[model samples]
Target: MGTFGRRLLLAVDAKGYGGADAVTQRQLQEAIRRLLSEAAAASGLEWERWETQVGGDSVFAVLPEGASEPDLVDTFMRHLDAGLRAFNHGRVRAAWLRLRAVVHFGSASPGAIGFVGRAPVEVGRMLDSAALKAALAAAPDACLALAVSPTVFNDVISDAYTTIRAQEFREVVVAEKEHTGRAWIRVPGYDARALDLGVPSGAGREGATGGGEVPDVRPPSAPTAPGDTVVQVINGTVHAPGSVFGISK
Candidate 1:
């Protein structure tokens, strides 16, 4: 039994894992371990000691007590992307590994089998969200896509506590199952300036992934089809491009 408190939550899932054969799935399981190990080590984290729950295609981790909030978001994330690039560098297109990650801060308690709490469940929901899945579907060249929960974004990302700029993340609402919440999406090393959103030809869409002519730096003015997401832009509301802004909702 573990005490419940504020802890750093992190999750990573391999893309298109189900379609692969058994050999490929085994390789991916190894890759998941390597990805987390290499990234954590690069970020100066002792991942072995972190409370972790591993699945066939994903890994859920809870940083040990007193974990550094800033490092997980900034350093760990940066290295995760870097590790992904390294893993896919020489592999064939079909053998390459792509990942989706979500970071959040929430209250949790360890249980007999795995983490038993809302935070872990929330992270899972966000991970399964169509908005996040569409993020990867939209960016064919990106190796990894990441989303931070509202708490993490507001407390750490929005406050510039990490090196990643707030504007780099596109704000979107994620509705998966019964859990609906806000999330910020980012694809490292890929340019989303010309994303091909799967929006209708001429629907009543303000800012959607439709028609493939839109970018993610803009805010989601009107809701689009279910599972579609739009980014929130500063609209040049601030004078400086690097200046930080707050989440309105």
Candidate 2:
């Protein structure tokens, strides 16, 4: 029978995946899978204990109950960063990869395809968050942008025992068509200088792609539409519509 227990849910998607041709997309899909395996192993995660499902340019994984979030942050994410860097080295711009990740904790019920639960759904929504996408767009030098659910952040990441520091994370509200919640963002390669820089604007230019010299043909701007509402908190104060949140960029 399939097992049921609390699990750490993780989802990762490659940025700019749809822009690539089918053949390159397939190649990148395989490469992402390989990189995830290698990164999991290098992070000292017990690969045998993880239930993984892969799509064309994304992966969903459920880690055993005892899995460590601090380990995920300090080890798995770092390994992923290094692995992607190594993979992108000497590769053409089109073949390069930048990723977005989401982590959450919840119950998991095993299924034929893999585990199924609200955790997976929540993490996927977190992965698709506008805040996460904007953060990645803002930081051109980062290879990975991670968003952690409030449960994970409070229980694991904010714990004093964890190697990851609280200052490393920025709070963001994840609002989408299906889900709305609080999440924390962290980029492995971000520096103080990078945060002050404006979002890049152009194709095939520097600061267009995350990591290395790869050129991202996609413009580095967050998606915006007329009359769309954005809710965010800056410095312990909530800013909703008609406030600074609606300020024109």
Candidate 3:
């Protein structure tokens, strides 16, 4: 059973999880948990208090509505980025951890299984978005890429509510079956516009050129387990399996 409520959504996924061998894949799993816990601690959110759904190389966390949204974007991101860099430091190339993360807000139901609604689905969409992947890929130095939903961007980050530097966020349009929205992408500590991710400087919010060559956003599909829900990537009305390093529910 599930109850509907306004919830704060957080989704994160490993950057290159599938290519890793068995042991390294396990390590990635551990690192994501630790990094998330640490970043949550640094940002003053209690990880244990969060309703988190964990699975193949990714996580969906539904935070309390009162949790500070601004800090999640700015402080949470900075700490997570730093934590990943530290994890990568002095570590073997095979064990290094990197992530693509997204934050959005909407009505969703917290159920016995996991969040069930368009909100959780949109969180997945935002995390799987092409712009978020490109920003992280374009800046190899960055250990994390963040995508902010239009609701969060408009209500908080864009209006000087946080220190995320609004100018650093590049708006991008993401469209998938039955879903479409404008999301802002950024890599912490790098030149955001240098990646050139749409959002015309002069055209206001009307037209968004996908900047550079938009990568093939066909996300990688993972093998299913006995007790897991898999969210596959769609390639024009057909589900394409394992197209890129990607996501699963």
On lDDT, the leading prediction is: 3
Per residue, candidate 3 scores C-alpha lDDT tens digits across 1-249 of: 567688787888888888899998887899898999999999998777887767668887878769889889888888899889988998776667879898988888744445566767777777876667777888877888888877787778767789866777766656666665567777887876566443334433233433333333332441111111111222364111121123222
Cα lDDT of model 2 by residue, 90-113, tens digit: 877777788988878887676554
Candidate 2 clashes between residue pairs 3 or more apart in a chain or in different chains:
none
Q: Stretches of candidate 1 above 4 Å error?
A: 191-194, 197-249
Q: TM-score, each model?
A: 0.77, 0.72, 0.78
Give Cα distance to truth, residue 164, candidate 3, Å.
Answer: 1.3
Q: Model 1: per-residue lDDT, tens digit, 1-249?
A: 468688787888889888888998898889888878888887777877776666678777778777887888889888877877887887777777888888888887756545666777777766766667777888877888888887787778777788887767766754333444567777886543234434332322233433333323224553222233453211212120110011010
In terms of TM-score, how similar is model 2 to the real structure? 0.72
Cα RMSD to the true fold for all candidates = 10.5, 13.2, 10.0
Among residues 3 or more apart in sequence or in different chains, the pairs in candidate 3 whose N, CA or C atoms overlap within 3 Å are none
Where does candidate 3 have its weakest 10-residue lDDT segment? 222-231
Best by TM-score: 3
| Candidate 3 wrong stretches, greater than 4 Å | 92-94, 196-234, 237-249
By lDDT, the better pick of 2 and 3 is 3
